[model samples]
Target chain A: MLKDITIGQYFPGNSVIHRMDPRMKIVLSIAYIVMLFMAKGFSGLAVGVVFLAICYGVSHIPVSLILKSLKPVVPIILFTAVLNMFFVEGDPLFQWAFITITKQGLSTAALMSVRIVCLIAGTSLLTYTTSPIVLTDGIERLLSPLKKLHLPVHELAMMMTIALRFIPTLIEETDKIMSAQKARGADLESGGLVQRAKALVPILIPLFISAFRRADDLALAMECRCYRGGEGRTRMKQLKLTSRDIVGAIIVALTIVAIILLNIFFPLAIA
Target chain B: MAAITVEHLSHVYSQGTPFEKTAVDDVSLTIEEGEFVGVIGHTGSGKSTLIQHFNGLLKPTSGRILVEDRDMWADPKKIREFRFKVGLVFQYPEYQLFEETVAKDIAFGPSNMGLSPEEVQMRVQQAAQFVGLRADKLEKSPFELSGGQKRRVAIAGVMAMNPKVLILDEPTAGLDPRGRDKVLGEIKQYHKTQGNTVLLVSHSMEDIARYADRVLVMNKGKVAMFDTTENVFARSEELAAMGLAVPQVSRICRGLAARGLNIDPNCYTIEQAKQQLLALRAGKGADQNA
Candidate 1:
């Protein structure tokens, strides 16, 4: 049933974070990702955690929802943690046959897991809070300055918006296609890997054809509506960086600064 | 025993999410064997959702669907068997036909059922015959067929399975009147020959009245009414309130009845109206001549 797919999901809200100019939010998200990496020692990681906590609190998005998004990536997180714990060479903390857990290895494992989790969480918050339309609109405007370099920013953004908008459409189409094939006794979920993959051909072929047809129709419809490449296309809602966005950016920047200073000035306890 | 029995079924889509919605509220119905049942509702009235459950295509959020008294979801793993038992033709089924040749496409279901190649070939020919697909067209690529033909071929894929309960969700949709009649005629013929239960979900009131013996009117995810065509069409006002119209001819008859005509206001078909009018005229003539 492909139930666990959480991509392109949005959380509708009236929080200050949700209302911010998506352009400002996008840039701030980048800053937050950097701050996550900058955090090294325990003090530094603490600052990163507090900053992420503040962002989450302001967004008004439930903690459980964020944790739910982390479900799909749990195995990856564990893999990274285990790899760091067992592979990194340092003073041995626990010697168990061939695999040795070192003090530095454990610390690296902990910090890396935290960094990866925070990175995913921060990026996801932007998507979860801001509607895809607004996000794409902001991206188009931000990338407009690059049009002189022939970057096709408008086209790219338009494509992204259309793709984001059609995620549900495609999912519904897939469900329909699955049902259609199922009526014909297509046993998609059962069988071995090869059989399963073969079964998906019926679904995938129809889906691909339909997607292409939809794109063609959408293009024609866009032309009919006189949507000519974002040129002179005035948005109904203009993007403006509010005080909340500026304040959020400032907090994130300060956290990064504190992490850098902590790494520079303090000796690590584990070391 | 009825071919299909739904017992107090309810469905909530995306349950527990902020965008959660209840599509079908508690609805129970029994579709008698060999009877043609039409499910009519406004868009999102859960007609589609309800039909999906009847065939085991969808697992109900709560409640049971019984195909000849056997629970549909008793073993979810064997849902494929249920599908063969209840053939579901989804709207725009042509889009689902992926095989290269018409014969191959029609044989998909029987082939998937692990039938022998010879039996699948026989079923394909029989299914094509049932849908009135020409023998010459069997070898052609499905993409070469016209819209209506493609729909038939898609439908034939399921019909090839020889299901006991055949359900079609808007089989005649997007087709011209001639095309619609062709498809409907085939469905009625299929029911007559197969002696199986037929559940048709459609938005067209006329189509339902024309073919279905019993009509289940869905309104806001609940069974608003379940009765014979004559009775259901008689409650035109209630249907109107639910944003559904009575059959076209019945609407006209009701309008005429309201304006002091001694016509049968409950008649929903053209043939019924004609017979009633002839009787009315005969009665008037008898009075005048006497």
Candidate 2:
């Protein structure tokens, strides 16, 4: 059941989005988020929606997967929409006893919901396309300039890469440990909150011990290979920005310009 | 009555996802009560997945598993009871030991069954004795013990439950030869004393030939054969085709037979092979005298 997590999940493909330089993808994703917030009304948000749709189309990721990524954020979207709907005061569109659905409130709620959905969809697309190792490499390269301030950028990136690499291994271990405990009649499903938490003691202790053991072994293995703090290190796959990355940056710039124009020229009627 | 029954069992990992793959296909088998069955298979042949169904640790994607003639997942909520009926000791179970004391680790199983403290203590002592763990060492922390000792403790933890059926998946993996023999001997003795059904999954054909009453051969998620140990070992070529082999003694006997000697190719155990060679020599001597 733990395998259902779509966070940090990478769907591998040979599409243009997947092949784009990871550094370019990360920068464009941040730029897209900024554009979404800059959007003033439905017309401005429509630009983001169109750009996102086109990106997904080229990436070849299935619609079901995109929907799966949005599933966990449904409650957050609803909460934001409801807070905007009833709490904001303006010209009342509909009135009951104490609650007033104002004209401005409805427009703001719709706009916020559209913006939040587009934000999630756009960002998840980046993770879906870029592999985790490449993503970390991209981040480290982008942060390389901070070395002038004596920051341990490479060490931090190495730590993140190692942590990401061990997630699936640790998850497999957890499943094995849980099954081993259950075979001995460990009741993890039914109980009060305290009882359930107490039952996890059997699982947690073993998991922690195994994880530490793995880390120790990994460190030893790295040392045996003459690893020394990422200094003077060489990479197997060098990151290079091809024409695909350049074209993607241009498309993103155009989308941002379109959002700016729409924000100025076309505002929602109610707003 | 059969101790465990699997009907058309199939398990698919990550179903409906792009990573979907069937780990176990449409397989059916029944293990009789008080029978010691050795399951032989290559890695990824679904040996582990198939046994996990016996105790409802994994629900089959399209089949039913019955323990002691009752459908394991019929109630779903009461499935824990089946775990107590069929105990599973996973591969390298020594890594699962987490208690402060060896005594406490063995008691984990019985205590989880809601047994009284006294009953739990009694069962823990019995299990420890069965696994040859001394009374004095019971108070020591399990983490401080040697690898073989920790493995025994993990086995005792499950044995304390006194399940009607015990399934072990490569329990001797990563152990020394002596350690492997000790653990396997303890399990054989436990089966004899308790008269419970036992399924031992191993890659070592010699070990299975030494202890198993019957052998079950699995290949590519299907039961290729299930028969008496002698019968399974006799078909060495067929077994070799499945990436398995008979005991080394049996292979030697087969070679002798191929060389026109009157040796039984089905002789698996060392004792049996010795007896066969002795009989063949005696018969030759008598014929020469005639």
Candidate 3:
């Protein structure tokens, strides 16, 4: 029953986005998010919508998957939209006993909802196209400059890679343990709050024990391989920015510039 | 009466997505009460997925499962009770133990059934005895026990529920020879004494040949063969084609048969092979005397 989580999952594909340099993809993802926040009106949001559509088309990732990633944050989107609709004060469109709806509030609410959806879709594209190993490699390389400040960049990346690799293993282990417990009639579904929390005792204890056991084994295996921290380590696949990456960067730069110009020149009527 | 019946059952994993694939496909079988059935298949052949359906652990994508002629999904609310009646001990069950003491761990199932404390204690002791665990060891923490001992405790935990039809998925997996024998022996004893149905899922043909009365051969998510142990082993070549093999004794018998010896190729155990060889010798001696 714990299999519904799709966060941090990567989809394998042979698209241009997948082929781009991982570091460039990371930068573009951050740039896309910043562009969404910088946008002000319908014309600006239109740029984001067009950019995301182009990305979806080029990545070959199904639109449904991008929407699936937004499922968990749907409540937050709705909550913000509702709050903005009723709380913002401007030319009132409708007035009730204790509530008033304004044109500005309605416009702000629409803009906020569109911005949130675009923001999630844009970031999800990064993870969908790039594998975890490549993503971490990119992150470690990007953060390498911070080593001058004594930050453990390589170690942190190593930890993240290990964690990502074990997610599926731990999930499969948890599934097995849950089935074993359920076969013995452990009531996990029906119970009060306290009873439910108590039921987790049987699952949690075993899970924690196995996790530690796995960690110990991994440490031993790493020691056997002489894995001395990230110092002087060489990678088999070097990350290099090619002509395609430069062209992609140019397109993103042009899109961001166009968004800024559009926000300045083609402001929405409500704003 | 059939202890369990699967009718045209099919299970698809991650349906409606790119990962959609059928794990079990239109499989149907009937298991009689008090019978020991062995399910053999290669990895990803749907052996694990099929057994999980017996206890309502997995809902069939199409068709139904009947336990004692009653539809298992007829009353979804009481499905937990069905689990008590059809206990499933998964592979590497030792990892499921969590209670502080072995006794409490064994009692977990019975307590979940809301039995009286006294009855729970009685069942726990009975299960421990069945598994060859000493009474004194019950007070110790489960974490303190060795790997094989911890596995026994986990098995006893399910046995404490006294399920009518016990399904074990590779119970002997990862155990040493002696440990494997001990666990399999206890399962045989439990079936014999309690007269309850047992479904053993294993990849080892020898284990099934020695213990199972009937064998169910699964191939590519379908039931390829289901018959008496002798009959299934008789078609060892077909099993081999499916990436399975017969017992070593059966292979030896097949070799003798190939050399024109009048021995049954289906002789699986050592005792059967010995008798076949002795009979062949007697017939040869009689012919020479004539």
Question: What DockQ does every candidate get?
Answer: 0.73, 0.78, 0.84
Find the 10 residues in a row with the least total lDDT in model 2 chain B.
B258-267
Predicted model with the maximum DockQ = 3
Q: Candidate 2's residue-wise lDDT over B1-290, tens digit each?
A: 98988899999999997799898999999999999999999999889999998898999999888887899999999999999999999999988999999999999999999999999999999999989999988999999999999999999999999999999999999999999999999999999999999999999998999999999998998999999999999888899998898889988988999999988777899999899999988998999999
What DockQ would candidate 2 receive versus the native complex?
0.78
Q: What tens-digit string does per-residue lDDT give for candidate 3 at A1-271? A: 5777654669999988899999999998899998998788799889889989998998899877887889989999999999999999999999999899999999999999999999888888999999999999999999999999999999999999999998888888888888888898989998799999998888889999999999999999999999999999999999999998999999989889988998889887455
Each prediction's RMSD over C-alphas, in Å, is 2.6, 2.2, 2.5
Docking verdict class for candidate 2: medium
lDDT of 2 at B173: 96
Better of 1 and 3 by TM-score: 3
**Looking at model 2, what is the TM-score of chain A?**
0.97
User: How close to the true structure is residue A36 of candidate 1, measured as C-alpha lDDT?
Assistant: 75
Model 1 DockQ class: medium
How much is B85 displaced in model 2, in angstroms?
1.5
Off by over 4 Å in 3: A263-271, B260-263, B276-290
True contacts kept of 2: 0.88
